[model samples]
Target chain A: MNTPEPFLGATSHTPVRHHILSVLVENKAGVLARVAGLFARRGFNIYSLAVAPAETKARFSRITIVVDAESAPLEQIVEQLDKLVNVVAISDIAPKDALERELLLATIKTDVDNRTSLLDVVGNYGAAIVDVDAGSVTLMLAGTPAACDELERELESYTTLELHRTGRVALPRLGKAAVAADPD
Target chain B: MGGLFLYLTKRIIVQLTGAQALIKSLEMEGVEVIFGLPGGAILPVYDPLIDSSVRHVLVRHEQGAGHMAEGYALATGRPGVAMVTSGPGATNIVTPIGNAHMDSTPLVVITGQVSSAAIGTDAFQECDITGITMGITKHNFLVKSAHEIPRAVAAAFHIATTGRPGPVLVDVPKDIAQSMMEWWYPASIEELDLPGYHPVVDLDADRVAQAIELIRVAERPVLYVGGGTLKSHASAQLLAFAERTGMPVVTTLMARGAFPDSHAQHLGMPGMHGMYAAVTAIQKCDLLISLGARFDDRVTGKIPAFAPHAKVIHVDIDKAEFNKVRRADVAIRSNVAAVLEAWDANQASPQNLEVWWKEINAWRETYPLVYDEPAVEGLLRPQHVIESIAKAAAPGTIVTSGVGQHQMWASQFWKFEEPGTWINSGGAGTMGFGVPAAIGAKAGRPDRVVWCIDGDGCFQMTAQELVTARSEGIPIKVAILNNAYLGMVRQWQEMFYDERYSEVYLSPDLPDYVKWAESMGCVGLRATNIEEMHAAIATANTINDVPVVIDFRTDSSEKVFPMVAAGASNDDIMVHPLQREQS
Candidate 1:
């Protein structure tokens, strides 16, 4: 019998960087479940996913998926998603090539002494105080996902009551030259 | 003037209930037959089915309906349609749906759902079938309104039949089926707003040229054909390509009839339980030109050792298939037929293959498929029984087999000369697929002969479908290789687990299959010896008015040979003991 060699093709690989996939799909019922079900059954891991109506809200929905490339090949993920009937288009956005943002909302307990300091911290991060209760204050931050992560880390010192983050949503960044070329 | 205008408009306008519209859509799509069973949720749809041109074969079980549709699709090269009620009916058919999905058979399965008001209430007989089948089906639709019926049916048929064909499910709620709507049908697939489903049929010029260049230079090339060739109707193209290039061809289980077994350039099947010459040639070949065949684990045993020395050029319609398993040197996304047609084989130059052919012919001679006579008298070998049936059957007979050692024997012993003649559950390996699939094949092609080669274990799973065949007057022949054991599992236990047979032995005489057939209103025959088996097959062929069941009491000691043990390298193929001793 011939000695078997280690087969290094598509099957053998090292985990690469996480990929940001922007998928456009028909705004139809169960479309999100279809996409999620595909990832679950195929053993593809999703780092984070966000879906909402696209620019054409009446017809299409845009889904931003942060995929753990370590679990499955990106090509396979895209191809499988493309096979879904509701999916319209898919674009893989490199971190540098895209603008990504996440909305973070947190309600934190505040006393008389810490209230002034908390307001200062919120203002420094460009966060707005949405609601102010006697013992707590609700702060909202809409910024880059990295910025939100940093803010969350800094706020760990405070007593946070409730927190919610609308996972990251992204779109390809406009080229510098294209932006400059625009007449407006 | 107002009265006249109103009267003319009223005469021109026509409205139809969703059920009527669904049936009308099927008729417009030229659907000849449907394999289905009706229930409360689907009762409304059945009312219109009675007045429609389409014929509905009432199946004994929903699972039978699904397999029949698959069999019909495999034989006729068209999308087979099956309809069932909700909940249990939907769940039962999931197996066949998965089977069709894996094999890429075109099928449209329709199921009735509870009323829209009762969808999420966990109402009686209400199941989330669309959600359940979303992963298995190629695509699925849940119609919310009555007007969507025609469009949904059109889309289901279109998606199921196009690209890499697969099963598509359409779940219609009871209320929607009873609601009224304006009747309309999409004139063509283009009219349907399916912007997401543009299958890549056009070949890329650069890739095609690169593939041909590799084929031209390779010293030893093998055409690895799969089920996609049959789906795309590329058998003629495949034959021409193989002949022009002087390359040997090996057909996968799903592709048995895609290439003629009689051809000189053809090597038999490859992989586990594959022919010795075919498996060895693939392992040693310099170029593996894969045509529409996925590198399935069964075909590529121990992927690291499979076609170790070969540079692969994989062509398939589904882009997802490329690089999903084995990386292709040249991956072309297009219909197999289109790719074959694009590669003008007539322009190919002849190359030297004398050494390759010499080695392959030697292997073929040394490890030829053979079986010894039964050690015990009056017991027939299953392989011999399959061979006997193949010999007695007509040229264009469609053969289906249930999953087991018998399925492998049918694949090995039968000689398939035309495309779409061999139908079996290849990828899913679903048991009880044979009888229903044979009935479906016979129903689809009334003029042709259909035979189901089954194992006793598999036969018992869905033998009830014989009643459906008898009642419908679709005569299909079934030959049960009664080994009284789960033959393949037993073989595995014997070889791998040291013969600790666990729940494998199904008593031979329990619920005797011959009597079981007779009880189902069909002719039943039994054959204990080789001569009797042959005579039984001949007798079954003569009687075409009703389904015939032949219980061939085959030897349980016989095991399929040329097997590369599960997860073992294809290089270590074990041939039959008799062949090994002779060699």
Candidate 2:
């Protein structure tokens, strides 16, 4: 009654390495779940993921993913994803060839005496306040991933109430902007 | 063409219920027969099927339908279709789906789902069939709208039969099957253009040149052929390549019939329970040409020690198969047949391997697949039964089996003369696969003789399919080696676990298979001695209108030889070490 084992490659105890994979898939109902299911069932570690309509029309979507290659190799993962019915193409976007960004939002508790100090601190990181409350100031920062990380590291002393960051999204610089990201 | 497309979409006025549309589409797909059962969620589909030209055989168990479909595909090289209801029906077919996936059998399993509103509510017969079968299927779809049926069905067939074949599933909810829509099947081949699944058939000429160079220079080169040879229908090309290169060939168990067994360069199956000559060739070869085969752990014992001196050149359709197990010095990810077609070896360097051939022939003679029948009174061994049956089988016979000692014996003894003639549950090794799968093969090719070599423990698992075979007039022969125990595990206990056999033995003569066969509308025969064994086989061979079952009360002590212990290297193979050989 046992099922056949999914063929897995020999694992090694090497240094952790990150790999960026761009997957183009058809825009179907369970396409996202199917791609995610492969990772869950195979025990591949996913660092981050982002999905948007691909350069095509509603027929396709592009999924950008960050993975820990040390845990599972990118070749096996891409091949497995390629087995999916809706998947269109898989490309590994090298960091040097693509522009990547991350967005972070931080809500800091501020008092009247120290509110000016926090404003100066937030302004230094090129962040703008999105909302204001009685005791908190919510700031949003969108930039290169490193820039957002630098801002988050510097804003730690402001008695931060809460913080959230979109993991990352990337696009190739020279080719063209995506053809199907609908403008609202 | 654009105006016609618009006109056809606008002018279509005939509306049929989803079930009718499904039946029509299946008719258009040229489906002549379907193996399935009806239940709450699938009654709508069944209703229209009764009036359709396609014939439906109602299976007693969903699992039988699945394996039958698998056998059908193997026999005809066409996609096999099975339909079952949701929940338990779907789960029952999971094993067959996995079996097909592992063996690369092309199958389309259509399972019923709960109504769209009741899908997640745990309605009667509700189960997530698509979700459950994601990993096992090449692709799966849960069709929410009746309008999606035409394209989805076409896509399922396309995905199932192309680019490394595997089982695909389409879960149709009850609402969609009963819903009404204007439908017409897709006509053009252009609609099947799958961009992501572009199977690159063009091989790198440099890789082929390198492979040819390696073949020319190597002293000892062996060809390891797997089931994909049969799947790609590349046996002729493979034979040509082997003959041209003069390299000895070893076929894996799944690839038993890929090359003719009688060929001089052909070594028998290799792995645990593999022949001595084949295993030795694999271990000693300087260059191993792996063709359309994944290096399964069963084939490569302990991984690292397997073929230590061999530089592998792996050629397969799937890219991931490269370095999946053994690393390939040169990897060509293309169709094996296509690659072989592109290979032009005009330079003839005749390098003689007379010494190597002599060594292989010597090993074949010294450690042949042989066993001594007992001189003791009335004790018939399983080996004798298999040997007798093997001698009696006609050319181009299709032999199937359940997983156990009997499978290994059949594999060892049966000389398959043609490709696509030997079918078994190789990867999944599901115990009940024999009877149903043989029935499927018989149904697909009524002109050929099909034999299911089964063990007592394995026979009981799906023997009820004998009734189905009788009803369908498949006329498949069942030869049960009645050992009264799970012989493989018992042999393991005797060797590895100090002979403490736990729950491995069945009650002696408990089920009375002779009477069971009779009740199932089969002519039952019993063979207690060598004379009756021959007579029983002769009698079975004569019966053409009805199915036959012959129960041979084989010696329980007989074990399969040339055994490699699980996770043990081939060099540590043991031949009847733990047991005494009777005169």
Candidate 3:
């Protein structure tokens, strides 16, 4: 934390890394705001954050936060979160042993000339057209973060009227994913 | 779990308002005292508090109330509590909240809110208090309904006093406080199962064995203890560990009383203003067993050079502290006391550290903290005044300090004889902390002598609280090192910024401190020379019935010595500004 801030775009010497952390916290109101306030105050970059009840009882909530690790060290981020009383536990869900997904919605300008091309390009990325208009098409896609990024890039050539992503949600591969190691 | 189930099944819930429920919950938690101020939004909570046994000490300002609660927490190993109204009151206490957060003090702060309906309407005295306090608090809650009071109060106390203790807040809106609800004394609050709130209370055996092994083989080892030892009440354990192993222990400013400062193996505070030998010891140590010490920037002048040669075994309750500033060879996440109890190691004798001790003693002899008579006649030396107070302070004196040169001087000069004897806003470096905190400490420990070592700049910040002490008959003695400047900042400007003292000087006409103390209905005296200082101290010592204040006009130009310039490595420590060439 005492180290100087690195440049925005990480150089090869310090390549940007995506760190997915599964945080378990008390299912209480305003907890989300408290967690978000911490990140805002400390300037810890959050790529995406998703929260929901972890169990049927609704006593606890699981927050999957995808952090941009080029900003702060992973252990420091985890330690800061651990200081929050509502936060119960935080685990790094290694990408290799985790299931990660994000939802993307894009409202595109689809005129008579590019409507077919837009639909064909969306089909190539396994996305569904949720709404359609004579001059616009709203498409929704749920897939790996990379896949969603790829689909967004693919549709860039066409006029993208608007776009929104649900960030990333992830769960660790449980029951001893054979080649996993826990930190000491 | 079974008790909670039984409590739920058999308990008879009675209707009560939020305010009444809050009082009952606090009583259930064995809260014996409260320091607070009443305001429009918090008036409802005060109504029921009258009927309760909890003694409430009305303070002049919310900041005083907050620091008082912090002092109470430090004195008693229990959570200190504060109550204030919303908006201005909530904002006023932010300093103390930040102070507690930094020093790891346990406190539960309750603020009165505007009516539930008026919350977001920008009604009179309404502020987003919970939102404003989120960054400084461990956790906070805004009770929207009367029914949430019991659960919220339970959770507040639970979270505030547990783990790496910090301040937790519960904001009760005026309507919610007035509204009626079914209430039962929660018998199961201790068993309240909030998932993911687990605090590590035990050490891993392997890590313990590994630490013991490191301690055994190390030729030049140092025990770096911090506030956690005192926070966890592991001071005795630390003393035992140091004694059993015969290792020299250096306590940080926050950990002043954790180990007896007079102990044979004790090295004074290690930091920018620490003893030369202590700082050098860290730089040269081979195995650094850091017990509950976070390598704070102040403690570690230059990160990479801090204990560079040492292999560290960092133990703390907050695992986030691991490698936060300095890397550790072995990290143990457990309560310091519990780990100390579980850890076992081979016995060590001084014979083993014969050479290491020789080196340490040589450094101590070579770099002794020294101050010659001030070149100007009649100009009192700050260090001389502090040392005199240290000489006069009785056993079990609880010393509180406001940040600046005085704070470092008090830490350096005072010989803490026991744990829970030194209380200051260490991590937050708060000014105006001394006066109110001393009053709070005196209130908590009436039998012991409480002293406030304050700087002139710091004393002016919360000096109004002296009125509270006078009215309440909290007889705390204050020793003001009246150096007419923000001494620490002036020193920095002198050393680093070429002495263009920028706004660091306080007006010489800032009211005679003696008259100011007398105006607050306290005995006041002024000391100009060493003889006058001793005489004034003696006079103050006899008059314990009322608060005493002594204004010792110390030299404005005297700077704290053995300072490692900010952002400079520890090895580059300098005793004087002109000697930077050798440094």
Off by over 4 Å in 2: A1-16, A110-117, A150-161, A175-184, B1-14, B344-350, B374-378, B578-583
Model 2 over residues B1-583: C-alpha lDDT tens digits?
9999888788656798888888888888788778988888888899999799997877789999999999889988998999999999999999999999999999988888999999789888888888888889998888878987877788788888888899989888999999998876777656754566655456778888877777677787788998878888888888887787677899998888888899988988999988888998889888888888899877888788898899988988887788767879988877778777766344422277777788888878767787765434676888888878888988788999999899999998889878878889988889989999998888888889999999989999899988899998889999999988998899899889999999998854789899999999999999988888999999999898888999998887778888888898887776654332421
TM-score of each candidate? Answer: 0.95, 0.92, 0.93
- Each model's DockQ? 0.35, 0.29, 0.50
Model 3 residue B559 lDDT score: 87
Computed on C-alpha atoms, the DockQ of candidate 1 is 0.35
Highest-lDDT candidate = 1
Ranked by TM-score, the better of candidates 1 and 2 is: 1
| lDDT per residue (tens digit) for residues A39-155 in model 3 | 888788888899888874567888888887878887788778877778877788766676677788999997888988887877777789999887899999887777777787788
Candidate 3 all-Cα RMSD: 5.4
Among all candidates shown, the one with the greatest DockQ: 3
DockQ of 2: 0.29
Using DockQ as the yardstick, the better of models 2 and 3 is 3
Candidate 3 C-alpha lDDT tens digits along B1-583:
9999998789576999889999998998899889899999889899999899998988999999999998888887788989999999999999999999889898999999999888789999889888888988887889878887888888888888777889998999998989899986556745454555655555688887777777778989998999899888898888887777789999999899999988988878898999888999999999988888889999999898888899998999888888888888888888788777666344433238889999999877777677766435576888888788778878788999999899988888788988888898888899999988888888888898999999989989988889889898899999999878999999889878999999998864487898999999999899888788889988988888889999988888888888888889999887744444544
| Model 2 residue pairs with clashes | none
Please list the residue runs of candidate 1 whose C-alpha ends up more than 4 Å from where it truly belongs after superposition: A1-16, A176-184, B1-11, B374-376, B581-583
- State the lDDT of candidate 2 residue by residue for A1-184, as single tens digits: 4333222113212124766677888887788888888999878888888888887867899888877777676667777777676787777766556566677899999899889988886677667899998999999987666677677777777788899987778876666433321110
